[model samples]
Target: MITDTIEKLVAKATQLVHLFNYCELCEQPIYQQVALCDHCVSLIPRFQLDSLSGDLLNRPEIYGLYSKCVFDHLIAISPYQYPMSDWLKQFKYLGRWQYQRLCCRVLNFHLNELLKLSDFCPPDIVMPVPIHINRWQHRGFNQTLPLARTVAKVFKVHCNADCLVRQNQTGSQAQASGQLRRKQLKNNFALLPNETSYETSNEVTGKRVKLEGMHVALVDDVVTTGATVSEISRLLKAANVAKVSVYCLALSL
Candidate 1:
C-alpha cells in the first residue's frame, strides 16, 4: 500500500511539473497563467497606429489597408516576421497548445485597445476560419479554433465553430500569388444550415434573418495575401452580416 501511494504521489508531482509554464522563445520560467516570459513578450514585433496614418476615408490605399475586400476592419497583433514566424510554425505544425495562451494574451491586449477607437464595437460573435475535414483530421486540431474561443471569452461573445464549413481540401496557399490564391479560394466556404440566425432576447429585438445586421469577428493564426479572409468575408456578406472584422496573430508584410 505504501509503495502504491508513493507511486501515485510521484505521478501527481510529474503532472504538476509539466503544468508549469515556460517561455517558448527563451525557455525561461514564466507565470503559470501565461506562455511567454516578460522579456520574450517585449521582443515580439508589434504594429503601430502611426503606420496607418492617413485620410482613411479619402485615401484608397489607407482604406484598403484596414477596411476593404469585404471586411470592415482588420486587427493584427504582429507582423509575420522573425520570431513570430518561427513561433507560429511550432504552434501549428508541432501542436504547441501553450502558444495559444501566448497568442490570446497579446490579442486580448490589442483587441481591447482597438475597441476603444471610435465606431469600433465588440463583435456579436466570433468564428474561426475553418480547415477542410481531411486536413483537420490529419492535423488532429484546427489551430484557429483555440484563438477564436479565447478571443470570444475575452470579449464575452459567443464562438460558433460550426457556423462556417470548408467544403474542400484546398491545398496550402503559401506559394500562390494574390490572384491565384483568390481563384483557389472561391466557393470554398458554406454556412451550416441550422446556424443562420443570431439568438438574442426580445429586448435586443433579435430576429432570424440570415445574420441580418450582425457583426462578426473572424479569427485566424496568420494572414498572408488575405485570400482566406477575403473569401470568408465574401460569404459572410452574402449572408447579409452587417460587418465582418478579421483578427489575426500576424500579418505578412
Candidate 2:
C-alpha cells in the first residue's frame, strides 16, 4: 500500500510540472492547460472570415493588394495583432516550446469550424513548411512541425514533415520585403525521394513524387506577404497536387 501511494504521489508531481496553470500574458493562475487566461484569449484579435469581405473568400487571386498563387484556400487562427504577435515572438524566437500547445489548440478549433464549411475539405496530408538543415540545427526545432503534427492529429490525417524538403539555407524572411522574400524562396523546396512509396530514403534522386489527386495543407507559424506559402503552393501544384491550402497561426494584416 505504501509503494502504491508513493507511485501516485510521483505521478501527480510529474503532472503538475507539465501542467500550465498560469496565463502566459498576465501570469495569473488559470484552471486549464492553456497558455492564456480567459481574459487574454478574449482580448486577442481573432480572424473572422465571415465578417470579412466576400472578395477575400471567393476571389482567392488577391488578398488585399498581395497576389496569391497556387494555394486555393487560406485559414488563419488570428490576426497578427497585439498579444498574439507577442506570443508568436516568444514561441518562435525566444524558444518557449510550451506555447505550442496553446497555439495548436486554437488552430485546431478554428480548423474544425473551417472543415464544416460547404466548400472546404480535409486534406489528405498535412505538412509543415520545411526549414533548411542549418536553420533547424540553429533553432533545435522546426516551430511549424509541432503545430502541423497537432493539427494532423486533430484531423486524423498524415503529418509528413519529410514530404517537403527545404534545400537552401536562405536567411530569415522576417526582415525582407515581399518581392525579395519571393525571389529568395523560389526553387528552395523539393519533394522527398521515394515520397510516393511512403518510404523514407536518404538518396536525393531527381525523381519527383506524383501527388496527382491529393489535397495538401501547408502549415506555418505566420503569414506576412503570402510569398513563402505561395511559392511552396506553386511547387506542390507543379507536382500535380490537386489542391493546396495554407494554414497559419496568424496573418499579418
Candidate 3:
C-alpha cells in the first residue's frame, strides 16, 4: 500500500511538471503536456505522404527501401534522422522517459492528419512488435508498446499485446545488412493461441477475442529492412488476419 501511494504521488508530480513544462528543445514555456513546442513539432521532417492513398509505402522511394513487403499499409511520422534519431536513442537506450512522450505526441499528431483523408482505413486492432522476454528483462519495457497504445487510443481500437510473442533474441539490426537481418529473424516470432484475451492492462483472461479476418496494426519504433514486421506479418496472415497495417515512428533508409 505504501509503495502504491508513493507511485501515485510520483505520477501526480510528473503530471504537474508536464502541466507547467518548458519545451525540451526550445526552452519555451509549454502550457500543455507536450514535451516539445508546436514549432519544434512542425520542424520535425515528415515521411512524404502518398497523394492518393495516404499510405507512406505507396510512395516509390519509401517502398523501394524495403527488400520485400508483407504488410498492406505503412504509416510513419518521419524518416529516421536528426532529432528523431536522437530522441529514439535516448528513449530506447538511455531510458529517458520524456522522449517516449515526445514520440507518442508526434505520432498522434500525424495519425490525426491521416484520418482526415477520405480513403484512409484504421485497423480493427493494434499491437506492438514483441521483444524477446530476455530483452524485456534487460530493458524493463518494450518501447513500442506505448506507441502501440497511442495508436490504439487514436483509432479507438483494442490494444492487444498478448497475441504475438517473440521466441528469440537477435543481435542489433541497426548496422546489419538486410539479408543478415532476414536470416537472423527467421522463425523468431510466434503468435499466442488466438483464444487468449487481454485486459486493458494486458493481463490474460479466459474471455476470447476473435482475430480471424480482423485488420491488425503492427506498431514498431523503427523499420529499417522491414524484416521484423514482415516476419510477424507472415504469422498474422497465416492466422487468417485479413490485413496487417504497419505503424511506425520512423523508416530507416
Candidate 4:
C-alpha cells in the first residue's frame, strides 16, 4: 500500500494523540485500531470448546457467555482482556464513559467483519442492553448506549437504546456458576406492555414498553458470563425478534 503525504500526516497525528493516551495498564502507547495495552493484549484467552453450546446453554460464564454474545449475531470482534481492578472505579466510580467511546469508534473499522458474520448484510436496529432505572440513577448513565449510538451513526441503523432493559434489582452476575446464575435471575426480565413500532422510542418504564423486532444487533460494554446474553436472547425471542446478533466492544476472553 502506498502512503500518500496527507494520509501519512493524518496517521502520524493519530499516533501522537494515542501516544499521549497510552493504555493505563501496560504503560505503552496505543495506536490506531489498537484494542488493548500490551500486557492486556497478552492476556487474551483461547478457550477450547467441543462446541459453542456449552457456553450458550450450560456453562457460558466460562466463556464469559453472558447470554449476550452468541445467538445474538455472529459476533465479529472483541477487546475484552482488560483488567480494571478498581471494582468501583472501572464500572461505577471514576466516570469511565468518556474512554468507552473509543471502543465503539474502533468498531467502525470492524463493520465489514460484522456484516460477514451474517449471511444477510446489516441489521435494522442497533440495540444496547438497557440498564435498570435504579442502576442508571446510581451510575447517572448507561455506558453501552453511547457506544451503540455512535455505532448507529457510523452504520446508519436506528440506534434503539430503549428496547431491551435490565430490570430493577437484578443481582450482578459477576462470578457465578451457570445454574446458580440462572437461579439468581429467575423471572428477572420482563417486556413492557406497549408498542415497539418504528415511531416509538424503544424504551421500557415501570408502566411502558417500546421496541419491535425486524433484525436486532445487541450491543453491550462487556460480556463475562454467557448468562446475560442468554437471558437477553430469551427475552428477544419472546418479543419476536427475527435474528438477534451481538456487537460488543469487549469480551472477557
Q: How far is 249's C-alpha from truth in model 1 (Å)? A: 0.5
Measured by C-alpha RMSD in angstroms, how accurate is candidate 4?
8.5
- Cα lDDT, all candidates: 0.76, 0.75, 0.85, 0.57
What TM-score, computed on C-alpha atoms, does each candidate reach?
0.78, 0.77, 0.85, 0.62
1-253 per-residue lDDT for model 2 (tens digits): 9999999999998887677488777898776676666676656678665443211434344354455456777777787876678777878888887777667767766666665666556777788998889888998899999889877877776678877888898887788998898899889888875664342233645444456778888999998888888888988888778998788888785
lDDT of 4 by residue, 50-116 (tens): 2332122334443344433336444534435533223223644557653453354445545533444
Off by over 4 Å in 3: 1-19, 50-52, 194-208
Is candidate 2 or 3 superior in TM-score? Answer: 3
Number of the predicted model whose lDDT against the real structure is largest: 3
Q: Write model 1 residue lDDT over 94-209, tens digit each, in one string.
A: 88876666777677666665556665567888999999999999999998998898788777877889889999887887888888987888898999879876555345556554
lDDT of 2 at 198: 45
Q: How accurate locally is residue 100 in candidate 4, as Cα lDDT from 0 to 100? A: 53
* TM-score of candidate 2 to 2 decimals: 0.77
The clash count for each model shown is 0, 0, 0, 20
Best by TM-score: 3
Off by over 4 Å in 1: 1-31, 37-42, 49-68, 115-119, 198-210
Model 3: per-residue Cα lDDT over 208-244, one tens digit each:
5678788999999998889999999998899889999
